[model samples]
Every structure is written in structure tokens, then in C-alpha cells.
Target: MKKRFRILVTGSAGFIGHHLMLALQRAGHHTVGLDALNNYYDPKLKFRRLQEQGFNTEEIKYDTLLSNSTLHGSYFIQLDLADAPALQQLFKAQAFDIVINLAAQAGVRHSIDHPEQYVASNLVGFANILECCRRNRIKHLLFASSSSVYGLNQDIPFSTSHRTDEPISFYAATKKANEVMAHSYAHLYSLPITGLRFFTVYGPWGRPDMAYYIFSKAIVEGKPIRIFNYGDMLRDFTYVDDVVEGVMQLLDVKPATGKAPYKLYNIGNNQPEQLMEAVAILERLLQRKAKLDLHPIQPGDVRATFADVEDLALETGFKPQTSLREGLSKFIDWFKMYHKINEVHALQEG
Candidate 1:
């Protein structure tokens, strides 16, 4: 099979997007990256990632063809999925073989304060993507769904067959909606769609809003970290490399159809570790202790998350091998170098 083909990857400037694009490029695939470059967190960081990947930083604009260059014959266009006509035009121009949709308003807590963002990005934006794929007759579509869909299931290891109607947050609800929407398109139009329910993904170039990044930043700066749920939360923290690898494996593997080509799977570490356990690991990695301020769990927060990866293993040979300790160590090392933190004393005295 010729794995090297034109692939359209949304959220290409994001943490996972950046890593996934690099992986595809390394595997000799021609990729096209599209991102809104919104100031959701920091556009500078996004641009930096693009620059690191050999994209010309100076040419990039909010919504323009910043560059036509890449290390692996890749292309980039500054586009938003919400713009229906613009997205349609891009699909018309590129004729993408496969699409991996990773762009969405991401944080769970943020969704509580700003539910509209979720509706716009996760709902409407996703609809646009589906429309484009159908019109272009794309071979396959893969999207990023969250483990948050498990909501209050209280299941030990979340399975694909589990009932996911009880979503605790607006964010989780929107993700579940995306799954339903994708399944509908697959059944209606014969579009092969696969949705991956990702667990707590943390590593280098991660989102600033994520717990590991925020907590680590606070801990390093001697600020009191918000230890929510009295530090009783647990998560299946999966590493970035494992995530990209699993996604790469699915490039050639389209959703199989007995009746319709629609499938969903959970991609995560089978092990769930406590919030405090993760903090402790971070502390050990940074050589500094956290000034913990334990508090009650916030709204839209879950007590635990675990993933059942049997389906993923059976389909793609996906296995998460990085331990929390090892992942945390690599993250801390990158964090220090990225921020130019000289010493533990400097980190503490800051």
C-alpha cells in the first residue's frame, strides 16, 4: 500500500498536530496543515512550532497562504473550519485523500465558562469538516474525541461499547455529539470515519490549559497549585509519542463496515494514576515540591479516567509503553530547556 499520499491535518500547529505532522512527514507522506491560529492560548507558541518544522514564520498571516514549503513536500494554509466556503474551496483545491481533525475548543473547565466556544468549534466546525469530506469523497476521516465522554460512568476501564449519554460537562457533551455526527455521516454517505477517545495527553509542547502544564508552571514559579478534588482525581496520562504512533498506524486502516464504516476506540494508558501521584512524579522530576492547596472538585470535573485498549490493540497494534515517571521526566527536561530555567533555586525563588 502506498502510505505516502496527501493528508489533511487540522490543528496542525497544536501539540498533537505538530507531532503528528512531523511523524507523517518522516514517514514520507505529503501533508497539508490547516489551523485558525486563534489566540485561544498563544499564537506565538503555535507559530514557533511551525517554524521549528521549517515553515517560514515571517510569511504566516491569520488567514493566508503563509508558505508553500516543508521538509517533506508539505503545504500549509491558514484557514478556519468554521468558514464553510473557505473550507470547501480548500477541499476543492487539495482533494485530500484522508483527513485527521484535531481542531476544537479543548479545555473542560473552559467549556463551563464559555460553552459557546465548544458549540462553535466542536459542533459547527466539525460539521464543516464532515461536509468537506463528503463533498471531496475523501477515503477516510479520523477525529480526536476525549475520554471525558465517559462522564460519570464509574467504569473501571472505559470501553467503546459503554453508554456515553451521561456527559458531565458541556465539553464532554460536545465530544459525544461529534461522535454521533460522524456516525451519521458515515451511515448516510458511506464516509469511513474513526473517532479516537484520547485520555490525559501530556508531554512536550502541550497545551497551557492542561493540568500538567499549568501545575508544573505554578510549581516551578513557587505559586500555590490548585489541588482539586482534594487531590483524589486519577487519569490515564498517555504520552505524546504513543499518541502520534497510534494515529499513524491508522492512516491506511479505514473504518470497516459490516453495514456502515463507522468505528470508535479509546486511545490511552490502561493504567490510571491519582492526581497527587502525578504531582509527586512532577515534583521528583523538577527537584522541587509543590505548594499544594487542596480544594473541592470543580464543576465539569471527573473523579477518574481509565481506557480499555483491547479494540485499539486488535485493530492497530496500539500499545502505550511510556510510564508516568519517564514521561514526566522528559516533559520536565523539555520544560526547563524551553523556558530557560537555570536551577531549582531559581525555580523556587521565582
Candidate 2:
């Protein structure tokens, strides 16, 4: 029998974290979650996510203990990742066997305008996590990295072995910094660290800032949708469930200690989908046509992203296999139900 470990998942109220939270609890592993609930997009959705995890939003207070009775009394807390003292205290109190750092300042465009937020959250907050992990002697640490680190390399399928030195956006640069930083910590402290470079992850409970959510909303509400690069982009859009599956499998597979207890893998669908094609699928799902506003690609945007998941597959015998349409269909089903957009006009007015 596999040993069950106590796990801490940061960004637990976020899309990917929330999904992983449920999975961990169902698998009979004790899970603790932490989220800042910042208004990066909308705190309303974040609250709803917490509710889904069986936490009452009315009782939400910073640094306060919250747990879900329905999910085997799983613990959760509302706290910023940058709060070092709080994090350290939590680490010491919880005595977690595994820590997954999914909390970070997400969004490439937002990083351009608010670079300071990125620095505080990604850099400073991550340093705090590394310290706590080192001090607490946690067995393993896993962090969410992004494919944007590829930075328009023109490499057909981005591989883990490829150079990630040229990150085009501040967000990507920060993620690259995380990879190197984690490597150093793993080397110096002998910490087992695994980094996942997720592609365009999408599905239900997804971030509103992502293209899929934005386009879906626009199409549903009969508004114009902006298509960048004249909708000529390609993305290895990995579904949220698939990403979670990869993470779960990797949790049991630690890095071999020789040089450094560190490993990085590209967690993606390994299948690139066209931007316009995804839009078309959305239109079919929503039964509405989108008013297209074609524009040049924005700065910090890449033309295409393709992942080489050979290492991931070989290591874990798992690969992201969700088809774009199937994943989008599931997301649309949840989206419509979540937003109560059965009657589009009401959602538009509100």
C-alpha cells in the first residue's frame, strides 16, 4: 500500500489548487490549503471556490483556522504567501510532509504594469517558502512554473532540456528565476524539489484573465471579442484535470539525490490548438457568434507554444491527454451553470 502523506497546497482557492484540493482529500490524504484571496481578478469567484471546498466565506479571516467538515475536516487558511512569519508558524504547527507552492503572481500582462506585486509575491514569498521548507525539513516541494519561459524560442516542441534563459515577459522571467532559485535550494539544502511548467491550463473554475474565459463571456453576452495576432496563435492548452493528474503522480516520484534533489518537467497536452479554432468551438457551445476584433499580438505575447512531454511520460507513465473540445465542453457546461448564464441578457446587465 502507498503511504498517505500530509500535504499543503498554496493557492488552494485558485482554479488548479481547488481541483487538486478535492483530489487529495478524496485520495484519503490530509490536505491543507492557503490562499490570499486577493482581488487580482475578482474575489467573488475566489469566495465561491472556497465555498466549493466546504468553507464558509462569511467566517473567512486572515490567518484564522478554517476547515471543511464534509471533506474529512480538511484545514484551510486565508493568508498571503508573502507573510513569512505566518507561513513559518503554519509550517511548524501543521508539520506538513509535502508542500506544493502553487501560489504566485500570475498573468504576463499584469506583471508589466505591476512589477512590484510580482516581486513581492513570486520572489519574496517564494524565498519564504524555501526557508520554511528547509527549516521544517519537509520531504518534497513542488512549484508551478509556466511555459512562457520558452519565450518564442521557435522550438517546435518546447522541452525541459531546452534553454530557458530568454524569458520575454516579466512574468516569465520571474518563473525562470523560480526554477533557478529552487535548483540552488535543492543543491544547497538537499531539498527534493520538482517544478512543473504548465501550458495554457484551462477548464471549469478557471481564471477570468485567461483567453478562454474572456472570450466565452464576450460571446455569451453578445459583445465583441479581441483576437490577437489576427487569431494566428497556437497554444498547448492543457486541461486542469490533466494537470492535476500529473502533479498527483509526481508527488510519489521524488528526485534521486546525486548532484541536486531537483527535477523539472513540461506538463502540457503536447498538442497545440489554434486560437480561432478554440473560439469557433466556444461559439458552438454557447450558440452565439462572436464579434471579432482582430488585432496585432500584444507585447509579452508569444505566437505559439508546443510542449515535449517525453520526460514526463517516461517518468510517471502519465501525460496530459484531454482534447481541447472535450475540455472546453466541460468548462462551458460548468461556466453556464456557475454564472447562471442560461439567459445571457441577465448576466450582461449584472
Q: Which candidate is the best by TM-score?
A: 2
User: lDDT of each model, Cα atoms only?
Assistant: 0.87, 0.89
Q: What tens digits encode model 1's per-residue C-alpha lDDT throughout 1-350? A: 55577889999999999999888888888888888888889787788788867788567543333222233477677888899988887777666788999999888988989999888888999999999999999999999999999998976889989999999999999999999999999999999999999999989888888899988988888899998899988899999999988898888888878667999988898899988989988888877789999999999998989999999899888999899999888888878877778854454211
TM-scores, one per candidate? 0.94, 0.95
**lDDT minimum window of 10 residues, candidate 2:** 64-73
Q: What lDDT would candidate 2 get against the real structure?
A: 0.89
Q: 1-350, model 2: which lDDT tens digit per residue?
A: 67788898999999999999988887888878898889998888888888888888677544444322223347778888788988888887777889999999899999999999999999999999999999999999999999999996877899998988888899999999999999999999999999999999999999999999999988877899999999999999999999999999999889999889999999999999999999999999888899999999999999999999999899999866789999999999888878777554346311
Candidate 1 stretches greater than 4 Å from native: 61-72, 344-350
Candidate 2 has which clashing residue pairs, if any?
none
In candidate 1, position 330 carries an lDDT of 88
